[model samples]
Target: MLDVLPIFSGDDRITRLFTLVPGSDFEADALSAIDALGGHTVPWSEACDGTYDLVVAASPKGDLSQLRGPHVLLPHGAGFNKSIPHEGSADSASGLDPAYLRRIGHDDTPIALHALAHPHQVARLAATDPPAARHAKVIGDLTLERVLTSAPLRDRYRASLGTGARKLLALVSTWGPESLIQQHPGLPAQLAAQLAHDEYQLALVVHPNERSLLGTYELTERLAPALDAGMILPDSHEEWASVLIAADALITDHGSAALYYCAAQDRPIVSVHRGGGELIPDSPMAVLLGRIPQLGRAEDVAETLRAYRPGAGHAAAQAAFAPPGDAVDRLRTEIYALLGLTPPAHDVAARPLPLPAPAMRVPAAFDVHVETTAAGFRITRHPAGKALPGHHLAVEHGAADEQLARSAGLLYRRPLPASAAPVDLAWTADGWTRHALSAYPGCRSAAALLPSGECLLRVRGHERMYAVQTEPRPERGQVVRIDPAVALSAVHARLLSPQPAPESRTMLNCLIGERTFRIVLRPATDTEATHVI
Candidate 1:
């Protein structure tokens, strides 16, 4: 029996495959997915330490070296377009060379299984000279299979959107500076104005990255005009799928939204683009743009909608990319074959996987008491306090090591000053690092001043430190209290001077809520101060 570990990277669309692994009889655990997203599952370090026979990843990137067995890469979304140009294609303008793409965690990691979404992707990989191409195999689109098989779930989603008798239109967005929403900021409200509210219902699903940058509350407020016009914004991946199923027509910038919606629902599509040119030449977006009506202005959306019909691109999309109906079974077969074992006899019913819970933003109320010890300062949490499980206690001090919170909330060592420069006792979760901070709001900022009067900044709740300074330095022994509530809101900081001097060491001001704090810095000097406060 092979022990399989399915690694999920917070993309809820990818985690949909977890629903199919129940009856496989392979000792499979979803520790990686839980780690990538927020959940109280097995820790990633424990899951990766030779505990499983095989590791399956949703995307082609990630650190899979810890596994002693072969790893499998599954397509997280519609992999119809080649992310990088073909091996020697003269498209250097896209900056997608094989080497650069591979280094950035593209699907070209050797010694791994590359499961293609369709035969077209297999052919595309075969044409490349990369070693990853040799491991590529067609496994079909598992997400599409999940969407198509679940009728009741989809209906519930549609009903929740109030799609009673009106046609639904989903406007999907992607990341990057050149993404659809970035290119046309006014597209959502513009499209809403063109469609009749009584006859048509509009739904918006912005990329999770974009949503994170602007924040859910901020994004919703930004799109209040559309929401007031009866346009629904699906907050979760499940709701997004419901909008896709209910949508009679789809309008998207050249992202996976075009391919997945068009292929799965056979819906008519309108591809939007900036007037300059296509983002990716000869991509699936280009193909869809050529087949469907391309819009450059919001004024043209209504006209294009009138001319387009449902399932107009079904035949062409199906012919170009054949998405299999039995993708889940195909994936299971591939897994068994790779392990040289017979397929287990089981009826794996298509069940709905739980949607990920939204991240918490405000710091939880905790009863923290500080005590001084010989080694350092010790902080303890009262038994009656409440916090999200798996949160590690991180101090704002630059030299402090993160301590995991025990059931009794006995966090050992490092006491910060109660009136010190906004020393934050942050509750950080696993996988809430600098790179992945946009997804979680709870651990966005954790900054504090050390005993030496040097400022230590932790952005997105990660341990990466930056030395910042403010003009008019605080007295060496004065208890300068930087408000934790205010200092955590600074988005970015830069040292204005190369050298840290009393006169020149000033930091660009950061916003703490409505207030701005100008921090000053001095070179990190040795200090023997025992207690901070």
Candidate 2:
């Protein structure tokens, strides 16, 4: 009889049997636990036992070559487990493996075994409780549950979370001398006494490898006093959580620790990430980092901490923790079913609906009317809608270039980096070119420059009138007019045309409303103007 009570798979209600080969009682115990839970079992033999569908063998000298088939192996220990993956073709057992399961056989007959203690039994084998709550009861009675039960109540809860009167900021500090070195990289050796100061407590939890070097006098001077203040150098997750739960705000160098603390506490986190380090947009760390705002200064952190209020923040945090509808429960059920186990009949309760996706301010797409000649490149702009596509040109009457330049704002002229590909432009007075453009610089206009002068302006809606006063020397009124073929009104015709490449030798400045665009008029090259300016 095996004690399956220690390895109850959480959420995965699948039933499966397991056992270990002779001479490995330690592994046998683990396998017995697995088998007692309802997993299928097969005898390991020289000829390979056909009595069972899956044969598992555990031995230092076990011949795995004969045990070959589409089978999964539960190797004992991480080192041996990793070796199995590298050496044998068998899929080694791991908790995450979709096939480390209970159901088996071609006929799909359900294997019967002595029932395991329950899913929560896995905690007995763990050093510490896993962060994600195991029992529904623990989460069901949370304060979040109250707020989630009603819409108006939810709103009030969220608003309260955001209404902190003071922010209690905490900066996590490590103990090792290397940690001290990281914190104060520029401490002078000569003025050591003068520089000896303690502003905050340091919680020094250092890895064994870092303990030796931490005994330096200089490191002690820098770190000890802070610890005396209230700083903690905690090594374990529990310790870190305790500190974070009490502190109003958190600051950290990396994103993972910060995320765990923030999500658990619903505390506002300020990331003090390493300079020049950017979290990848698609990674889990990045997803977590998105929740916290980045604060550049310790003072800012102190200020925010001074105003933080726990109860108020709890509602917002609870709302954040709540899932969309009963999606989480549904998912939990599905995962268990897939693992070949009957899910428990946990009662579902009503909760507030998920908040809507955040509103984003997306700029309107642009239409470009372009033409090039011996003089320069010309372009116009208008909003994205097709209602009046070719009817709106930035340059109207006597004020095309200036109006376009002003509308373009900083988009008109940009210095190309030395490493970038060279640009080309062709200037012709007649048969001008037109193109639709997007991400035009200024709010409503395009950028353009004509032979008349340099400074830019804005072109009104659907009208061929440009407006702005760039140069003030002589009386070149703020706006001027250029060719109408490449005017803002001609945007539609340009967009409808097939894209062509610009000549390598032709480079010119393009003006779309007030923004200036540098277009390489490479006829034989892709005309997708890499926005330089």
Candidate 3:
């Protein structure tokens, strides 16, 4: 079952008959009009048993909670003339409120105008004073009960109307010749004119502005030869609906008439660019509708309209704008998984190896890498990478013959800070040494120094340590290779001794992974080696 909840306000009986109505114009008159048609006085009672499987409302004032069923029609207005009457059991003025009209004219009440539903007599109305036909719906903002009239065979009426005349009608404004050009700089003028012409015939109905002859003149002059002349312009809402209900397409500019007409009738549409090339981001038309195609050039307008014909290829065309395959395929896969089915094998790759962990903890120091295991714990003492949470920092060395096993672990409460630097490490083979740099604030720190005779220095030297600073480089998940010889030359390092003596000598500036360590060459003099090394 299809559920539709349309809001309208014009005739009170339609509201009283349905579950919900969006209010529209001529509130008091609309109620009287519906009262005159239904003949039966409806009492204030909530009907919610699906007595009617479908609820059709034309005004916005009717409450939808009263009916539990499918709804059709949006209780909105498309400037339908409710003050005028049509030659039928329904009277226009009676269906609308005179007081409401006065309030609206006086700006005391802001109300929307709706079109009346009557698709059968559109062609006849157009042949006469089309504006005089009152075939449109009206919805007032203040009351929904004013316009709801019980139309006994609305479904049958729709079905029958679908087979007659044109399938859709679009109303648009034509202000200037450059309007189309400004919107679509790439389009040609002649093509746009033809598309507009084709939209009228292929669509069930069309209502061009009577005040402006530029659009009509252009259509009759340049596009008339190639078009079917059966398409006629109607001036009234009655004629608009008669064509709209049966139309395959509705093409128009961004006018309120086009906006509410397509919305109220549930018609597919094409909106031409009317003003500046750009559309307002928060415009009402964009918010309430979709599937609107653009028609800028004269030659393509007609073809664009023909493409949206009800049975021609709307589904495919619409799919071109919004594809429908991804969600369905995803659902199918999920359903199979729920059914305990082995999913079909596809090309999938293996995961990559993880990086090392932080050698030690330091507050406000991020980018510490570390990895702990039962066999042993490995820590990368660098401040330039990430480490997993819950890594073991301290390890218990194995007994005389047993293998080493990690016993304790620490999970970090937050991510490590990147602002801290790794200065040095002091250690024996047993476990992690005291690693230090600048203070890590409330965290442990230890700085390994060069031998006493050699001296500890910054990137520059001990003399310039207070002023030494490094430049930032772009390195994300990467390793850069460098040669010691070239690096020494770049930093202008001076050798302390021609070739270091044994035991006390080593390349103190070499950085391996995260920890900085040196390769010992030979021992220093007895006196020098005694105190360091």
The per-residue C-alpha lDDT of model 2 at residue 371 equals 57
**Model 1 clashing residue pairs (backbone):** 8-33, 420-481, 421-482, 422-482, 469-519, 469-520, 469-521, 470-519, 470-520
TM-scores for all predictions? 0.53, 0.27, 0.25
- Runs off by more than 4 Å, candidate 1: 1-51, 80-112, 151-156, 275-279, 309-312, 340-344, 352-533
> Least accurate stretch of 10 residues (summed lDDT) in model 3?
141-150
lDDT of 2 by residue, 1-533 (tens): 11111123343543444434443323443444455545566555633443334333222233333433333222111111111232223443222122322222123222211111112223321212222112111111122222223434433322232211212344543322223236433222211111111112223333222333343344446554343222334433223333444444565543233433444456655444443222323233334434455555433544544444444333323322433244334433433443456655664443332332111211123234345433443444332231133323332212234444334322222123345436755422111111211334333433334433322222223222122222222224433333222322232223223533221333344343343433322222122122222
> How many pairs collide in each candidate, listed in order?
9, 99, 111
Winner on TM-score (1 vs 2): 1
Once superposed on the true structure, which residue ranges of model 2 sit more than 4 Å away at CA? Answer: 1-168, 172-223, 264-268, 282-301, 304-332, 344-533
For 1-533, candidate 3 gives per-residue lDDT tens digits of 00111121222323335222334233343344346545343433534444443344443233443544433223232222222223222332222323222222112222222222223223323433243233222212111111112122233333433322213343444223323213332232232223321112332222332223334456444433222222343322233443333345555543334543443234456666543422323333433224456665545655565555342223322211222223223322332343345444442111111111111222122222233233222222211112232222211112111111112111111112233447743232111211112212222211112222131122211221111111222345533332221122112222222332223333333332332323222222324222221
For every candidate in turn, the CA RMSD to the true structure comes to 22.4, 26.4, 29.5
- Least accurate 10 contiguous residues by lDDT in model 1: 1-10
Best by lDDT: 1
Per-residue accuracy of model 1 over 61-83 as CA lDDT, tens digit each? 33444434566766654644434
> In candidate 2, what residue range of length 10 has the lowest lDDT sum?
190-199
Model 3 off-target regions past 4 Å?
1-171, 174-228, 264-267, 277-281, 288-291, 298-533
